[model samples]
Target: MPLTGRNFLYLLIASGIYFLSARFAVLLFSLEPGNIALIWLPSGIGLLMVLRFGYWAVPFIVVASYLANSAGMAAVLSELAWLHTSTAALSNGLESALAATLMRRLLPEGLQSFQDIFPFVFGVCLVSTAVNSTILVVNLVMAGFFAVESSWMIWLILIVTNSLGILLLIPLAQAVLQAWESRLQMRLGDAARCIALFIICTGMTWLAFDMFAGFIFLIMPALMFLAVQGRKESVYVTLTVTVGLTVALAAENYGPFQLQTDEWSRLYLLSYLYSLIVLVLGTELYQRDLLSEVQARQSWQYRAHHDALTSLGNRSLFIPLLENEMKRAERMNRAFALALIDLDNFKSFNDSFGHALGDKVLKEFAQLVRKNLRDIDVAARMGGDEFAILFPETPMSEARHAVERLRKQVEKLTIKYHGRTIQFTISSGLAEFIPHEKHTSDAILGRVDQLLYEAKRQGRNQVQA
Candidate 1:
């Protein structure tokens, strides 16, 4: 119950952050540190939102903004406060929600590290900004500022500038929150990168003359972080930059801080866009690197155990494990069987057709035997046209039954190579190894081989026990 409650609280916080962030972006363009001092507390709660929740979070955000604006409006003008507040919230909500939804669809497959940050930001944040900014423009027009013809210029400026503002804040927000929470696995190197990101964001916030220049310088450090750092660090870096920029602008009494409504809105959208791109790119790069490492290791491991052609476990890995199992079974006073299977008329088929057909026949025969075995059972190709199964806790009689089934399955299998179809059967030998038997692993394998020879001698396609 406690866990559930904590989770609920977390959801509220995250959703609130998402909502407020969108709302704030629409209203002020920039989330001035001063303006958001009280409101920004809700942002961190989003970590608890299930991935599915990022979709519905937009509307809640819009309402939060409306509430904030209403409170502001009431503090000053009491008349028509409700109407203005609702209009503000709805416009922001529609745009932000649409963007978040689009992002959810294009969301990367797995959440890795810094590499995925950029793409995620571009998809979720930039797109969201575009949507929300458009809605903001429409709302202004609806308020009788102008018709589409007169408002088109303002709309374009609002969309582009605000989107940049939102993009800028994303990294700063990510850095502060993610770092404080220790969400990213950061060693000395990651810490250095985060600090570097802070410096760059701060410099841009303090030194840059125009929005475009601010973004260009600010995003450079972010791109660097995304390309190299892991997920947590990348987000941390983005967040920190965003927060720093907002704080700086507010301190200077610029744009959102001074209630320069248009500039504030532009900055807000840009900040969100920055955050979205960084998040996506960081995630992609990190996951891609991890997947590559995994694949490399798996390939190395497979090469050790499996036949290159047939993908059946080869002699090196299979024989030793089988021997160990046999030893364990003997100590427990249990019985087990090793069955040796040899393809009959294999050489003849190869002579009549080709070595390609022979290889195909061997692979098909291995598959057939593998399909007949239990999941716990180990099947291996001892050599060309030769295979074996270690049947744990089985007696001689049961082993013989298994061998018969295998033979029948093999007989049913056919291989086609170069349009020539050839059928083949296998002869199997079932041999039991008991505790009292004076047999080494080699001796047991040799016994099965001898039985296999006997089966071949008796006839080409029968099981000999």
Candidate 2:
């Protein structure tokens, strides 16, 4: 929708979801940042909200912050707390809005597919998160609200988690939306595969941590399998589940990438990067599938309008063109000509030799007829050994000249078939429509067809206008 009251309501609902989700993330994953949380989802979801709704939703980030911040609603009643929370919320909202803005400017296809994935990964994930984290940290330090001892750690955590949230989580949500709109169709088999793959990956992750620490890369193949075999939704669901389980396992000191450090930032960075692989590859697969579908559609359309043997416009495409030209010439008081071409003794070529050579002769003869025509002229294969040509805005003299020139070319043309040379000639009839002649396409074609038979009756190797 539009910028209406209902949209504001949607903004509120989205903000509420962001608030709750961010709070839940903080409660589960906290470090030395004093409840500042590692996986900062509010910012990522804020970006999604602005992209989904409009920039008008940015201010509601404050509402999300107030509801989710460790400092409760009562603390916000105080002047100092209110100022601090407002600053943080504004910083979050502005950075996310900046991400949406920069992505709009940078991504060529505007967040649609793999085409725009690079810009989002760089602009929204890395650059936007870095800006947000830096600003928030500097603000807290200047305001003396946060201790400066662990400022670097806080910044690093914010950057990685924020990037993870945007790259990993946002795509999951985007996939669901695409599936809802029927843009990305997910089959039951694909969903089943994704679930099974996730289970297998989780088990492997558990085993790798328990037995072989070096085998931590086991989830890669599973995710890659899902990305290759599934649609956008299945790839997204598989990645999300894998990330969640791996993070949970690593956080609890069960996974292999568990460096002995107090902050498990390595897992965050590595897991995010690996998940990045899945997202990009999955989107590329989707793009290829989409391109294949478009090509298939275009192929069908071409076959529908064109002759297979000659690769020329067929009857299905010719008549409408004639009608359009008729309408235009009638309206503008201009002139156009229509011609029908029939090759003499064409059946002898097929019967004496084979249909293959006859087809080759026909194709060559069609090309001969098409020689030296104006851009607005149309040539079509009416059927076996019969063709139609249309010349828009041409008078009878030029129309007759074009037909005679093509006939002479057909006379000289020769097709070589298996050490034998097949030679042929064409008989054609030309019909011109002046503005004064109020004729339909059928009437003109009928008259031209009669002229063609007349040329044949008069002895074949000639043109009659």
Candidate 3:
């Protein structure tokens, strides 16, 4: 890539971070003959850079790996350090590029489900890391760094460490990236829960490594709780801290695995940590998918039953609601009221002011209905300029009074559109259903329709019962 301003800045930052993480890993956990750490953090860093910036990041990875490896070997190998470090750098860069490409191909949707975990682990982690480790170990053997017979063991160690690096870091990195992209905000309770999980994991890590081996198992439950109840990013953060602490203490011979050889201990820990990562991430992703599905279903249902223009319950919803209220009134041996309302001269108003203003007027009237009605009352936009209201267990006198009040409110309702003032009014028909009276919902609706036309006939802007 050309050294444009943004590209140069990204390369500089990526190379610096990769170099620092490599040096840190070498200083803390370098193995014999190759300076290979049991947990090679730079591998993960390089892969993250490749995934973020594409293949443009490979040159920076190669440069950083060369510097880190040559710094460790220059004094001893002197002349040959250049050759060995060059090969190792190429391998590191190649590993990152290959892993990123494979991940994109295998998980086109990113890691958001249980099925994604398998492809990520097998395709990106094991396959790419194995190839890179083989290349590096072969170069070491050719340079006389280790015996030919020992190449297999060295390659095995490199695979385990490199795989562990990618497995541990990538999921956490993805979570951080997703959170950043979404501009996620945490509520007070959620923030508190995340902090509590972090504290619990930290304390548990100390006890497990420094005091009791059995305490390590308890950390899994803590992580599981965070995965299920806390945010995805928070869960990954707790996992990273817990794993980092466990590895650091174990390397210092402070943990239960100290009894085993260093290589075997690292391997065992890697296995446990890999399983932990999968289980926690899998649960979080599954829960997220289920939540998305539920939200989508609810949105569909709401759109299906509600009016698009006014957001009131449409005919599909109102008829069933009316029937249910009638059934309840009969069961309670009570009377209930229904009101059918029509806007006066709405067609002429629509022609005069345009459909846009007519829509605004309808929406405003729906809001008014919502504001004036009780919670138990039901309002629906039956069709254009026609609305229905259900007042359960209310007598005709009470219903008529409510309708009259609404009529007065409609007379005072004025809508201003584009500096043009528009005034409107409503005519309503009220019908009451008394218990022991044989009536179907359609019969009552027909009666209300006749009364509504009768009100319109007498004059507009009046209520007829």
Question: For each candidate, what is the lDDT?
Answer: 0.62, 0.75, 0.84
By TM-score, the best candidate is: 3
- Name the candidate that leads on lDDT: 3
| Model 1 clash tally, residue pairs | 77
Candidate 2 stretches with Cα past 4 Å from truth are: 31-36, 70-79, 112-115, 143-149, 183-188, 206-215, 264-465
**Candidate order by lDDT, highest to lowest?**
3, 2, 1
Q: Encode model 2's per-residue lDDT on 330-436: one tens digit a residue.
A: 89999888899899998988899988888889878766666667777999999888999999999999999988988888788777788987788889899888886
Q: Name every residue pair that clashes in candidate 2.
A: none
**TM agreement with the true structure for every prediction:** 0.45, 0.61, 0.91
lDDT score for residue 203 of model 2: 78
lDDT of 3: 0.84
The local lDDT score (0 to 100) that residue 121 gets in candidate 1 is 54
